[model samples]
Target: MAAQRMRDRWKTTLADSPYGVRTIEAIRPVLDQWVDRRHGLLTYRLVQLLSGHGSFGHYLHKVARRETSPSCHECGDADDTAQHTLEVCNRWNAQRHTLVATIGGDFSLPSVVANMLSGEESWEAVVFFCEEVISHKEAAERAREDTVDANPLRCRRRGRRRTQFAARLIP
Candidate 1:
């Protein structure tokens, strides 16, 4: 049953295909290493999600395919997926930059997610990244509201405040 589900989910073409075999083989070493590390709750949860053991992969699929929209709690974007939420979304780029800068290297979404799931990066960094993402999302939302409200005071206040706040927090 699990095998069938995996085949369907990944849209496997040839039976026992080389790519499939290699993907599973690659994942095996990571899984073995994770077991040895005895990761704490956060890591354990991340592993569960990444592996489709729990609802993580399912939820991600739903968001990515637009089957569901977990409104960016911060930016209020109707659609939120791992890619959009982390990479392409301009609203959260500032925060993402801060987190990436802390890691100190060229990093992309896939690398970050892989490092996070493989426990290659410190948990502190992961937690900080999550918090920064959320913070920027909220800032984006507030800015949006200010724009729509058309109130001179709110507009003026947020414009000056956000720039200063971002400068201080980011640099």
Candidate 2:
């Protein structure tokens, strides 16, 4: 009966929330082990991690709901979830693809999340991958902004063009 309840709750949670669905699906293999009574203790830890309502889980929830904009730092298009960050953000596709290739293919959100949660991959590796992608995206955006800022006409100076150019170059 308890097992049935867990399963029912899982299904209902998934149906009710995209974030919940993603989290649960990402951790499904570990969750499935709970169905066997022998793994009850490990399962309890999984549940705590899944339903803890702490910052870790809440981050995912926020991302999925678009409450926090996961916009591509490159193109500035909204990409508000793990899946979008991993697979669909066109601005970061080349970097993302390269990173995933290094990690091995079939690198969907669930798989990455699973690896992260399960400790199959080192935390350093995960952190490095995320930081690199975000940094690359941010650098792209900064480059775009710098290009716009550096254009002489866009600076809008009241002085002569040569003076403005010289003044701008001085800084």
Candidate 3:
């Protein structure tokens, strides 16, 4: 019950975000209740993460500002938004292809993920996709950290890797 209320508050908060009102309304109904199911606990967790509410780069960039740009460091193109992570990022092309085969026909990420999770059918595939994304992203972030650690002088020369600013939240 507390989780559901938190999710609800999240929806309300998102409704006021830039261009989020309509999308949040559409996704609101499918928010998971996190009850026990036959499948593993991990799938449900991944589902929650991908539901545009998790700590993905999109969430961090927009809601937290830990990222310098909301644009994906992976593809270095489109904004590092939730839809982009699930649908557009080139780094996840193979995983996205596999998920398309499983989920079929261009379903909205939030709705389909929520349903598949609650039903526990094909939920594993969704989990696999999310896992692959996390693995690849972590690897890339680590590579970046290594480069910065090795060449701190070079990084500092270009005025790169500045400390991130915190985003403001309403009381």
Candidate 4:
């Protein structure tokens, strides 16, 4: 059919492109349909988990260079990536267990996508895990930021900047 041809063409084009390689690889195996009526709008946390561009230490410390170390703040793992958080991190074992219970033991990206497409309960389970885990990570990150901001050296640096700006204004 014409629609099938178009989808094939689109997939070919996307496969050839250099951009979005990570996203492409993640969904390439299981992306049969473009859209589904069962799923609702994606949340921030869900996007972060799916896209690998959020509070995870691998993204924050390595990809974004925001954090000092690429270690799991919760469990001290070498890398706190989306995969680790979803499939391996002990910090979220309970939540992961719940997801596994709903979607079965295979938590690979393709399995997850297939399971999500299968039913609402499976989709909600993934969403809940993403929300709870990412929310906790974000809150911990904010608390760390607050602690860092309270450092006397940081306050002195801010005062120094203000003093330099005032000096420039006087001239």
Candidate 5:
């Protein structure tokens, strides 16, 4: 079937390719095309954490130039990456404790994926942690952005670049 072929192609591509869902790949190294049995779609905050492309200071400061430093704004830890936020960040201790109580053991990407796949309650717990932590971070980021007058030229250039890139893809 076409779906099977696509799944096979995805598995092959993921095996060799360096990019594309590296976070999921890291946890589930031997990637299998699993069925989505869950009802709800992945949330924005959850996707951001999964993709490592959200309001994390490391990404904002280094990649987007939005923040002043890579250190965590809440805890002052170096490199406020998704992994750091999920696993070790003191800021999310209570939430982390709740997650740990639900899932047990050290919180890692693999564990998250495993627990999420195991049952609905586990999935909800992970989603709750992601929603709480990421929403707070996003709120902080918005507050910070509000205080600063972002450069209009920078925004225009970014839009222009996206348009130019899209144009290149078109015939």
Candidate 6:
């Protein structure tokens, strides 16, 4: 059937890509579930961050060579990473507290992310946390720009500005 063929193609694509089959299986609900459409953009970004398509300083240093240091700017001890942001950053303590309070109690990481991405109950909270992360990073970038730039940097919220360090992906 045509539907079966399409499914096979999608499966093959997921298997060949970075997330692979197992991860595709785990996060598939994030694709099909419709309860969180209001937070779609942020949810998509979160999914990208979780699935290795989004930016993180450690990943940038290790794989992309976009950043000079893997160490976190906020804490200055561990690598600036998704796992660190999600579970362990002291700088994000208040944001994480909000997330925990929204979700109610400690749950396993996978379950929490899954519910955030796919379930109706936690979408708004996840979006808020993600927005906080992005704003926090942007604020840090503005400070860095201020210290380094002879002319004060103007904060722009337009389309993404590509840098020389950005790697081109054919796909």
The number of the candidate with the highest TM-score is 4
Write down the worst ten-residue block by lDDT for model 3: 153-162
* Root-mean-square deviation of candidate 4: 7.0
lDDT of 3 by residue, 75-153 (tens): 8764776677777777788888888777764646556545555555567777777777776665665565468444342
Q: For residues 1-111, could you state the per-residue lDDT of candidate 1 as single tens digits? A: 885575455443433556434235434434434334544345433343233232222243353232233454445566454444545556666666775665544344435
Model 2: residues with Cα > 4 Å off, grouped in runs: 1-19, 31-73, 76-79, 115-123, 135-171
Could you tell which candidate, 4 or 5, scores higher by lDDT?
4
Give the alpha carbon lDDT tens digit for every residue of 37-116 in model 5. Answer: 55335788878877788989888877887667789989989899998899988999999999998888666677677777
TM-score of each: 0.38, 0.39, 0.58, 0.79, 0.78, 0.64
lDDT of 3 at 86: 74
RMSD of 3: 9.2
TM-score of 5: 0.78
TM-score pick, better of 1 and 5:
5
Q: How far off is residue 101 in model 2, in Å?
A: 2.9
Per-candidate Cα lDDT values, in order, are 0.47, 0.48, 0.61, 0.78, 0.76, 0.61
lDDT of 5 at 97: 93
| Model 2 / residue 12 / CA error / Å | 10
Clashing pairs in 4: none
Q: How close to the true structure is residue 64 of candidate 4, measured as C-alpha lDDT?
A: 69
Better structure of 3 and 5 per lDDT: 5
Q: What is the lDDT of residue 61 in candidate 5?
A: 77
- Candidate 2: tens digits of C-alpha lDDT, residues 1-171: 897797878766766675556566655645553244331133322333334322121232353231234344434555434445556667557666665644555566466544554443432344555556545533543454357544442233356886868887855
Q: Model 4, 29-92: lDDT tens per residue? A: 6656425345645789988888888888888877767677788988999999888898888989
